[model samples]
Target chain A: MLSIKNLHANIEGKEILKGINLEVNAGEVHAIMGPNGSGKSSLASVLAGRENYEVTEGEVWLDGKNLLDMKPEERAREGVFLAFQYPVEIPGVSNINFLRTALSEIRIHRNLPPLSAKEFLKMTKEKQELVEFEAKLANRSLNQGFSGGEKKRNEVFQLAMLDPKLSILDETDSGLDIDALRIVSNGINKLRSADNAFVLITHYQRLLEYIVPDFVHVLYNGQIVRSGTKELALELEEKGYDWLKEELQGQESINTK
Target chain B: MMEKDDMMLDELANKEYEFGFVTDIDMDISEVGLNEDTVRFISAKKNEPQWLLDWRMKGFKAFQKQEMPQWQNFKMPDIDFQSISYYAAPKKQAKYASLDEVDPELLRTFEKLGIPMSEQKQLAGVAVDVVFDSVSVSTTYKEHLNEMGIIFCSISEAVKNHPELVQKYLGTVVPHTDNTFASLNTAVFSDGSFVYIPKGVRCPMELSTYFRINAENTGQFERTLIIADEDSYVSYLEGCTAPMRDENQLHAAVVELIALKGAEIKYSTVQNWYPGDKDGKGGIFNFVTKRGACRGDHSKISWTQVETGSAITWKYPSLILQGDHSSGEFYSVAVTNNMQIADTGTKIHHIGANTKSRIISKGISAGRGQNSYRGLVQMGSKAKNARNFTQCDSLLIGDQCGAHTFPYIESKNNTATIEHEATTSKIGEDQVFYLNQRGIDAEQAIALIVNGYAKEVLNQLPMEFAVEAQKLLSLTLEGSVG
Candidate 1:
């Protein structure tokens, strides 16, 4: 459902994603694990068509359409969703109102009629219950004065409302407590289907235990250096990334010699 | 990204004014220049009484002695008084006996302005007094209003039919010597609405007036007066619009309101005059003075305004709380876009014990527009245990716009309490990006954010006016983004 080939991106004249190559089919769950400054979030940003990141050399495709040529709003209309790590707090803009505008615009772009108010409210109620989000929080200003956990939950709730084909969760579990982690993971699990895919970008292996992934890739220095199954996450948690760095250094020295 | 944002701002700055079409009917326009003869000409044309004529003469002398004040925040445009005609009206001066006798062309003009003057098509439960140029063409539902002891008609008619009421209340709130604009307005003001509610009566319908300026090179000076007698209640609204012209037109108006013992008056205005072109070559120079006085104990007065047009706007709707236990409130939402400049706010003077007041102002500036909020809150020595609260907020769109605040507060009574809060913020690019990622376009996003920001003040308007105000707010900032 998504493809990236030799993706090279930069921000402010400094290269971030050197050469990222990845492919994922529908219904598959992919977990990208990396340390700080390893381009995990950069990949998510590039796929979402953030304007600040300049794509020096790359080709990204979603459903056979070139993603890099589209604006951020067009990408969103084309079924690409990025759950932000830090959700913006827009004071005075109610959560329900914002969602209605977004849903209507996306539907119009897809040649479909907008949902009626009753239908929208029904859908909102169901989704709020699915994500275990507080009913009061759903009616307040977008994310103003919300707790960190509530923000993460709101992102999950939005993912359910938009129903994008492919959703990239960027550190959705960072500030969540154990209960919030379980609720969010359960929501994502319920949303999984044979027609959709999920890419989980996280720094810890703990998130993988709740929403188990079919493939786990370790991204180091802007490229994926290791690929394995769920067992790889446990191994990394036990031994850490130092062993992998040492092995890469030894390989570089041999190649130089 | 920055270049794209700049391009959007340019597109927003160039949005054309919609109500810029002139009515093609013949008009009776006065000759240019403002001297004693011009004032006499207007008063003689209205067939005023000797006392009224003397009052106009006094106002003219005062206007001659005063120069334009220099304390405003904007660069005051040079106005040549001799170049502007003082009055203009439709050619047919005979009073129409009914809607059928009114000219079709004049009816069509009001129809184009979304105000149908015909009895069948007029807005329900609202009486409108239509002022075309410098004369009142028709006042809807006057006979019905008269049945309830409420007098709603043109100010000129009030001067002839109800001279006692007109003479007693005229200039009582905003005197002719108040300021330069007030003085000029008092001298040459042609026609406006006059409303009065009798004692212990509640006006059954909303009273409204629609003012239209269609003649070129003519200045529109209108006077409006409203009075609520003892134990009465009334709500009044006014709207203004003018045609497009290459040369700027002047609109100096005076509005006075009075609330007697146990009475309440609620006044609202949606000012949407022509705002010139993208280059700011022409528009209306709106200088207005509006004030209300709580004359007796336990009276209340509130002013709610949404000002979205005019190239230069200078007005401050103020209140004087002279009656014990009286209250005053001001709520305003002023928007300036495409080289428009607006300097507006309100004043509250507490003179009686236990008086209270509240002020809320929201200013939005876009596309090189400059908006300033200047307000005064004064507590007199006799004001015991009085309280006042004020909140002023400004929102800026695009990089070239500006927002400023000038607040003056004086408290001579130790028992008085005053609280003030102010904030200035720019529309965040991050906020726009977040909305974009949700599939909402930039224009709709900015409109949503702005309407949300000004919700507090917009909520104070009546239901029908609130919807129009929201649409005007959105249209004023259609393509603006940060």
Candidate 2:
């Protein structure tokens, strides 16, 4: 469903992601577990078409379309969804109205009739039951006065609404309690399908226990050091990332000799 | 959307006010001058008493001796009073006792101006008194209000029927010799609405007046006085839209609001007077003197205005907090576009102990327009524990436009607290880019952001009127603001 060849990205003239090549097939969940400052969020932002990042050398193809050439909104219409690590707070704009506008814009781009208000409300009520969400929060301004836990849950709620083909959950468990962590993981698990995929980016393995991924790639120094199964995340959680640094140093010494 | 529009001064000539056209009604006009004779002519025509005529004569003399005011951010050719016909009333075919009896042509004129007197009563959820050219043609909901002990009618009628009430409060807030324009309006002011809410009664409905200047070269000097007796309350709204004219038409009116002990008065205006073409050819020179006095303890007065579509607007809706524990407030949104200039603000005087005042002003300027807010807040010696807060913000759309704020605070009381804040910035391009990334077109994004900026003021309007006014604001700046 997605392919990237030597994707090099930087922000503010500082290189972050260097020569990142990855591929994800349908029905496969890929987990990118990395240490701090491992260029994990930068990779997600660049793929989401955030304007600040400059892709110095790379090509990204999503289902045969040039994903890098599209604007953020166009990428959104083409089913590239990034559950932001920190959602922007837009004051004086209701959550429901913003969601409806986004939905209508995507529908218009795809030559579909705008969803009727009744249908939209019905869908909202259906998805709202996943987390037993309080409906009052929907009427408030977007992300304003929301707790850290509530903001993360609301991002998942938006993800459920948009139902993107390829989803990237960036640090979705950074600021969640155990219960909220379970709820967010369950919400993502229910949405996963053979035609859809998710990239769960996290620093700890605690979230991996709930939303177990098919594969985990260790990212260190802006490069994937080792690719392995779910056991890799548990191994890093046990010993720490210094073992990976030692492993990368040993590999570089071998290549030089 | 359309590749960014460059500044187009070529279409300036074509942007003349489409509604600035002179009507063909035969007018019984005063002679082409203003003097003691003109004052007497007006007082006599209205059958004024001797004392009233003396007051008019005094005001006429004051107006003659006084020079035009030069203490503001406005410049205009000296007003030739001799060139303006002071009193220009429509020649009625006959006296009409009912709304239908009045000329549909005249009512249709109001209709074309979007101020149907009948509908403003029936549809707009308010009573409307239409002052066309000079005379109050009709007043709606007067009888209904009278049942509630509310005397709502025209000023001229008030002088005839409620003589004592009119005489007692007419110039109490805004005196005849207050200024040049006030003196002129006091001398020959033809007609305006008057409301008197009796003690202990709340006005059941909003009272409104629609002023239209239709005749050519006619100066509209209307006087409106509203008196709320002890413990009474009333909300009044002033709305106006004028026909397009080439020469600058003088509109010097006076409105006085008096709220007795424990009384409250709220006045609002959506003034869309005729603004000239883009190059500023002709429009309404609206120099109005509107002031309110809280004469009794616990009284309150508030003024909220949305002023746009004027060539040169020079008015300050002010309040005098004279009673103990009284309150004053001014909330305004003034927009100047296409060579329009507005020097508008408010003044509050805290004369009694425990008085409070608040002022919030938002100014938007575009296309060579100039807008300014000049305000004053005073805490007198007797005003112990007085407080005031003011916030003035400006949004500049075109680089050539100007936005300014001048706030004057005077505090002699030791226990007074006053805070003022202001900010100025043009609509940034990065904001537009962000909204565009969210799938909104440029215009939609601009509308959303501008509406958000003006949310505080728009929320003060009634629900239905707020929706219409929001749509009007967008329509007024459809092609230009972004």
Candidate 3:
């Protein structure tokens, strides 16, 4: 459902994502694994159309439409969801009200009727149950004074609410405990459908254990150098990225000779 | 997104004031100038008794000696008192027994202001006293209130009909010699609402007054008095609007409230006097003095206001807690946009032991507007174990706008517990982007943020006033974001 070809991006004149090429069909799960500074999160940010990142060269297509031409809000309305690594704390804005506004905006963009107050509340309750979010947390300001686990759970709850076709979870499991990880993964698993896709950007193999990926790619130096099945994650966990770096150096020297 | 947001803000900046149209009606305007003769003319026009005329002469004498205040940060142009007309009222008879007797054009003016003076469209459960320029034209629900032994009528009507009540508590809370504006207001104050609730009785409905300024170059000086007798309760609200003009008009008003033992009084105000055009050419210079006195034990007084319009606003609504265990509260949300200036706050005086007071003030400044909060909390020596809590917050939308806070506190007894909290914040571009990313437009985002900032004060308003206040806030802060 999503395709990216040779995506070149930078921030402040420094290139971050040198060249990224990826394609994912419906019902497929792609896990992008890399170490710090390997551009995994940068790819997610570029795909989400963050203003700070300048797309130097490339094209990204979502449902046969050019994604780079849209604003961040337009991208959001067009079903591109990014679960921020650090959710913003919007003081004084109730969680429910913000979600309702967002839902209405999306509905208007899609030419659908706005949900009634009762229907909105019911949907919110259902989504809250699906993500196991606390009831009181939904009434307070958006993510204000929320615990780390609760913030992640709120992101998942929002994902359930929006029902986006492409959801890029950026390190959502970083600060989550084992129980939170299980709940988030179970929520995502329940949301996965044949018409949608998931791009899991994570640094550790721990998350893939609960929500298994169909394909695992090792992103090194802003490029995906190794691609394999789910077993590749176990191999990487057994042997860290140093061996991969050494193997890449050996291959570069051989090519030079 | 930033460009789109900027464009939207541009459109909002040029939005016209919808209530700026003037009603073409003949008026009974006073001769230009301020003097004893002018005050006497106003008194003669009202057919006042000798004591009331003498009181006006005293106010005029006091006003001549007092000087205009200069302590506020706002700069004021020298006002030519001689150039302003002291009184202007619609051409009508002295007394109207019913609505049909009132002038049709005057009724149309009220209708244009969205305040239907006609009986069929009058607001239910709320009695309104409509003040047109210098005189009260109509008062609704008078007989119903009278049946309950509650007196709600124009100040002139009260002086003629209920002389004893009017003489007993006219200026008890705010005397004519209190301030320059209060003195001037007393000297030629034409008409306003007067309410009196009997002992142990609760006012059945809300009491309201709508003040409108129609005549050019006329100064509106209206006085309001509300007294809740022992063990009584009442809720009073005031609103005002004016026509657009090229030269600034003056509106100096005085409001006094008194609550006796075991009584409670709640006062809410939504002041929407015409704020000048975008260039700040002409608007109302609203200088007001409003104060309440808690005279008996366990009495309470609360002031809630939403001020969003005016070229320059200078007002401080205060409360004197003279009774033991009496409580006073002030909740205000002041918004200034496009060169509007507002310097407003409240004063709380704890005179009796175990008294309590609370103040919550929110100020928003945008588009070169200047907003300030100046407050004072005083505890006398005999105010043993008194307590006070104050919270002041200011929000600025654009860099050109200004927000200020000045709080003065005096405590004579060590047992007084006073706490104060203040915060200042800006609506930054990143905050806007954060909301934009959630599919909310910039205008909606700004309005939401502002409403959230002023939620505490807005929550204190009555239901009808709350909705109107919300709308006024959005209108005032529109296009303020950069």
Candidate 4:
């Protein structure tokens, strides 16, 4: 469903994502784990068409369409969803109103008729229950004065409402407590289907323990160094990333000689 | 990406003014110039009584001695009084008995303005007094209102039919000598609406006035006076629009509202006059003086205005709380796009004990527009335990626009309590991007954010006007992002 070939990106004239290559079929979950500055978030931003990140090289294809040529809004309409690391707080815009606008715009872009008010409320209520989001928060200003746990839950709620083809969770579990992590994971687990895909970008294996991935890839210095199964996450969690850093340094020395 | 955003801002700022069509109608236009004769000419044209003429003559003398104000935030343009025709009215001077007697062309003009008189009568439950150029052409539901001892008619008609009431409250709230513009309006004012609600009666419908500036080179100086008697309540609304012209048109007017004992009055305005082209070549220079006086104990007055047009706007709708326990409220949303400049706010004076006032102002600036909110809240020595609360917020879209706030508070009584809050913020790029990532375009995103920012003020408007104000805000700042 998604393909990225030799993707290179830069921010402020400094390379961030250096020649990233990845591919995933439908119904697959991929986890990219790395150290602090391995460009995990940068990869998500580039795929979501953030304006500041200049893609200097590479092509990204989503289902057959060139994703890089589209605007951020167009990319969203093409079913690319990025759960931001820090969700913006927009005061005065009701969360329900924002969701309605997004849903209508996406539906219009896909040549689908808009949902009636009754149907929309029903869907909202059902999704709110599915994510266990407080009903009162749905009518309040968009994410204003929300707690860290509530914000992550709102993101999952939006993910459920938008029903995107490919979802990228960028550090979704970084600020969550154990309970919030379990709830968010439960929402994502229930939302998983054969027609959708997920990419979990995290620094620790804590989130992986909740929603185990089919493939785990170790990212180092803007490149994927190793690919393995779920057991690899436990191994890296116990050993730490220092061993991987030393191994990469040894490989560089050998190449120079 | 920045260049692309800039291009979109330029396109949004350069959008054409929608209400800029000239209405072709014969007009009785006065010769250019302002002098003693001009005042006498207007007074004699209206066939005013001797006392009224004397009052105008006094106003003219006051205007002659006063100088143009210098303390406004924006630079004032030099206006040549002699070059502007003081009065212009439709040739059909007689009042229309019904919609059938009104000219088709004039009706079409109002039709284009979205307020067809024939339809308005049946649809909005709003009694409209249609003021074309300078004269009141038709007043709907006057007879219906008269059944309840309510007097709703043109000011000129009121002068002839109800002289005592007109003379008693004409300048009671905003005297002619208050300022240069007020003096000028009092001296050469043509015609506007005059509403009087009798004691103990609640007005059944909204009273409205639609002012259209169609005649070229003419200044619209209309005067409005509304008096709510003891135990009465009334809500009044006014809307103004002008055609496109290469030369600036002056609109200097005065509005006076009086609330007697146990009375309440709510006045709302949606001013959408022509704001000129992107280069700011020509538009209306709106200088208005609107004031309401709570004359008796327990009276209340509220002012809600959405000002989205005019190249240069200098207005401050004020309140004088002279009655003990009286309250005043002002809610305004001022939007300036392209090269427009607006400096507007409110003033509340607490003269009696335990008076109260509240002010909420929101200013939005886009393109090269500059918006300023200047407000004053004064508590007199006798105003013991008086209270005032003010909130001023400014939102800027695009890097070229500007927003400013100036608030003045004076409290002479130690028992008085006053609180003021102010904030200035730019439309965050991240906010727009976040919305865009959810499938909403940048234009829609900006509009959503702005409408939300101004929601507090917009909620104060009447239902029908609130919808229009929301649409106007979106249209004024469409796609304008920094």
TM-scores, chain B, all models: 0.98, 0.94, 0.96, 0.98
Mind giving the per-residue lDDT tens digits that candidate 1 earns over B87-124?
88789874788878888877777777787566663446
The CA lDDT of each predicted structure is 0.91, 0.82, 0.88, 0.91
**Residue-wise lDDT of candidate 3 within B314-376, one digit each (tens)?**
999999999999999999999988878999999999999999999999999987789999999
lDDT of 1 by residue, A28-107 (tens): 89999988999999999889888889999979999999999998889999988888999989888899999999999899
- Candidate 4 interface CA RMSD, Å: 0.9
lDDT of 4 by residue, B200-302 (tens): 9999998988898888889999899999999999999898778888899999989999999999999999998899889988999999999999999999999
Put the candidates in TM-score order, highest first.
4, 1, 3, 2
lDDT (tens digit, per residue) of candidate 4 on A35-67: 999999999999998888999999999999999
DockQ of each: 0.70, 0.17, 0.46, 0.78
Q: Give the DockQ (C-alpha) for candidate 1.
A: 0.70
Evaluated at residue B232, the lDDT of candidate 1 is 99
- What does candidate 2's lDDT look like per residue over B1-482, in tens digits? 11233332223324455445555677888878877788888888888888788888888888888888887886855788888888888788333568788876776676666765664456656887777877777777777888988998878888889999988888988988899999988888888888999999999878888888888788999899999999999989887778877889989999999999999998888888898877788888989999999999999999988888778999999999999999998988888877889999999999999999989898988677899999999999999999999999998764678998889999898899999999887765555444444555545555665666677887777665566556656544544533
Error of 4 at B207 (Å): 2.0
- What digit string (tens of lDDT, one per residue) describes model 2 on residues A65-149? 9999987778878887888787756555677877777778877887888889999998888888865566888777767789988
Worst 10 residues of 1 chain B by lDDT: B115-124
Best candidate (score: TM-score) = 4
| Candidate that would win on lDDT | 4
Cα lDDT of candidate 4 equals 0.91
Q: By DockQ thresholds, what CAPRI class is model 1?
A: medium
Enumerate residue pairs that collide in model 1: none
Task: Sort candidate 4 into its docking category.
Answer: medium
Q: What level of docking quality does candidate 3 show?
A: acceptable
